[model samples]
Target: MRDSVSKDTLSDVKVQQRERGTLWERVRPGSLLMLVATCVGALLVLSPFLLVVLNAFKSPADYSTRGPLALPANFDLGPLQSYLDIIDFPKALTNSIVISVVVAVVGVLISVLAAYAIGIGRIKMRTGVLAVLLLGTMIPQEALIYPLFYIAQATGTLNTIWSVIIIFIVLQGAFGTYLLAGVLGTFPRELLEAARVDGASRWRILWTVVVPVIRPTLAVLMVFFFIWTWNEFYIPVVLLNSQDAQTIPIALATLRGQYTVDMTVVNAGSFLSLLPTIVFFLIFQKTLSNGVTAGAVK
Candidate 1:
């Protein structure tokens, strides 16, 4: 009886080991395939950016003759300099920076205040207000262009950076309010009550308590707003007719001629235009990630 029991135990162990091995084998292939697919997707998304960077260093002659994808036979800085001269890179970049920064800062401030009122304060008609704000996001810019142009023209803001900045602030503020309202709604009510009980005024409570707690979310919103403002093309093009007020996208478009466009020069300017946004993301990526995860978990 003892010998038979030992043999049965040994058989059971062997069977368990075989099952474990089979499970691992199945999982390994699926995981490998997922990794491969992710890599392929990343490659596809990054290929155009890579092409722009690569072609930026090439000469117009090389770009035209050797194909856009080809490596430059020799490094050439002429196209970059040419692009800078054509676009007046400094003025365009400065205008973009000013417009984007002011929009982001003002937009965030308005959004946080509005979101706090709606989400935390639980004001009357909060739901209706949120719905309207979100509805604004759905309205296509194309539809609003003529109306916006007329408004800018009447206001005498056309052909000025403020025209773009004002529009950006309003549009971005609505989006920020929508995002932050959800995040602020998840705040612990007890904390606010405690602040009030300790004699904190509404403004003090907002600045000292609510702001600190929701800073991550604010960072995320600011980054998004900044990027959107920086990349805004349509409004700037429609409003900023003068060369002095034009931003990077409009300047880049101006590089293209009706008859012919220089691929290398265009690529060079495009790559240069992307640098500020890339730097901004790299700097704020950690905060952005934390904000996203915190919002999700809360």
Candidate 2:
């Protein structure tokens, strides 16, 4: 009995030693170097955003005269205050929110349906259709501008928000077809075959089975579309001629004059413009990660 107890004691001691060794291993030189490097990179990336945040709180005089690195003498909302007045910030915010939500929703709906058709449905001429879609992606927007312009002029869509939204949804089809089709192709064939065997219609199977399985990919695509459409400058600038029809990008760019610049209010408006994309990415980062992993698992 004593010999067995001694052996047990020695085993416990060895386990404790191993635990300590592992803890020390985690704190070694290489690990410490990696930790430091990550922290430095994060700080460097965040510095510009921090500067903007700090500058947004400074008065125009403080912004021009005070050193950027120096702590503010006092936090002032004058920059933000002035921007709200000049740009009609509240109205612009509402416009941007409505445009982004509509574009994202419509883009996702159209793309998801197209992807489902191309991804899982077996049909003749599918390869031909896919080729055309991919060819559309290869055609640069710059190259197509003339045709798009003629279409807009002919359709009476120029200088309108509908023009922007319609163009966004059509542009989404290319990348959207490719991305979502790839994701849907990864679904197990057995799940689909089993669903069909159980008498579920194509639409029913899509809603009940396929959608839940590929929801992560859908979330990733939605967030991606939202960011791209929100930051889009060219399409909106070209299509929206009037100030009232203009989105945030044009509004912000117009803030800078030919002879003089209003850095204070411009920075504030730019910061505000970045908020939607930032919030979206942060919110959907986890689902994005999961979608990538789920795709890989297939």
Candidate 3:
């Protein structure tokens, strides 16, 4: 009887042990790994921005003497104030804003229309055309500096804001269209067909159906174009000969001198240059993750 009882208990315990298994197995390893990776990536990308923001509030003495890792014992707004006064911050800011806004808006608009035409419209030799467009995106713009210089000079746009705006639009929009075309290609043709069945004209369909559905792609393009245009240094430095036509990037570069660099003021100016893009992202960043991803998938 005692042996039978012991055997029964052992059997029941073995069954329960089999049911318990490992908790880790219940949670997906891939998901856990992805979460860890995403957190690390976020920190890596955002650390520089955060560091600049923190340093913006530090005095020149504090920033240079103390290590960057150290926190300011007392927050100071004086550095930003002094820096702004020292560099005619308002004028630089206005130039940056105007150029960035123009480039982003125009680039996205033209790219959207162009991408739609290539992706959905029955353009002749589409594969060949798309191949050409791909080449345009891959080619380095630096190679065309002299050609652009002559063109700008011939067109009488040298040392003007319009020159920068126009160049940026064309440069960034090509790449923007490349990305949007990929997203647009993933869209279902049935929707366009249905719109046509309802007697919607091509223009109407593009404006109403296509634009609304592809807002995600457009939003992403806008953010990217704006950031690129705002940060553009090379073309502006080369083309812009006058201070009045200078963008924030050019203005910030001018902060350096032959003898010494103004670390505090340069950091302050750099912080200012970043603010517009940061604000734009904060406003529309949802498109980056969900909207863009969903549109691409759809």
How are the candidates ranked when ordered by TM-score, highest leading? Answer: 1, 2, 3
Cα distance off (Å), candidate 2, residue 34 = 1.5
Encode model 3's per-residue lDDT on 202-298: one tens digit a residue. Answer: 8999899999987876777787787878888888888897888887788888878899975666777778888877788888778788665874573
Of the two candidates 1 and 3, the one with more favorable lDDT, higher being better, is 1
Candidate 2 lDDT by residue in tens digits, 1-298: 9999999999999999999999997787988999999999999999998887777777777877986676778977787877777786666666666777788888888887888888888556777877888888788778877788778889998877878788788888577887777767666899989999999999999999988987877887887788788888877787787777878888888888899987878878888877866887888889889977876775
Q: What would the TM-scores of all predictions be?
A: 0.88, 0.86, 0.80
Residue 179's lDDT within candidate 1 is: 82
* Native-referenced Cα lDDT, model 3: 0.82
**Which runs in model 1 stand beyond 4 Å of their true positions?**
1-27, 296-298
Which TM-score value belongs to model 2?
A: 0.86
Q: lDDT of model 1 at residue 106?
A: 99
Clashes of 2: 0
- What does candidate 1's lDDT look like per residue over 1-298, in tens digits? 9999999999999999999999887787778999999999999999989999999999888888999889998899988999988888999999999999999999999999999998899999988999999999889999989999999999999999998989989999998898889878888999999999999998999999999988887888888888888988987999999999999899999998999888889899999998888898899889889988976674
**Candidate 3, residue 127: lDDT:** 75
Instruction: Report the Cα lDDT for candidate 1.
Output: 0.91
lDDT of 1 at 113: 96
User: What TM-score does model 3 achieve against the real structure?
Assistant: 0.80
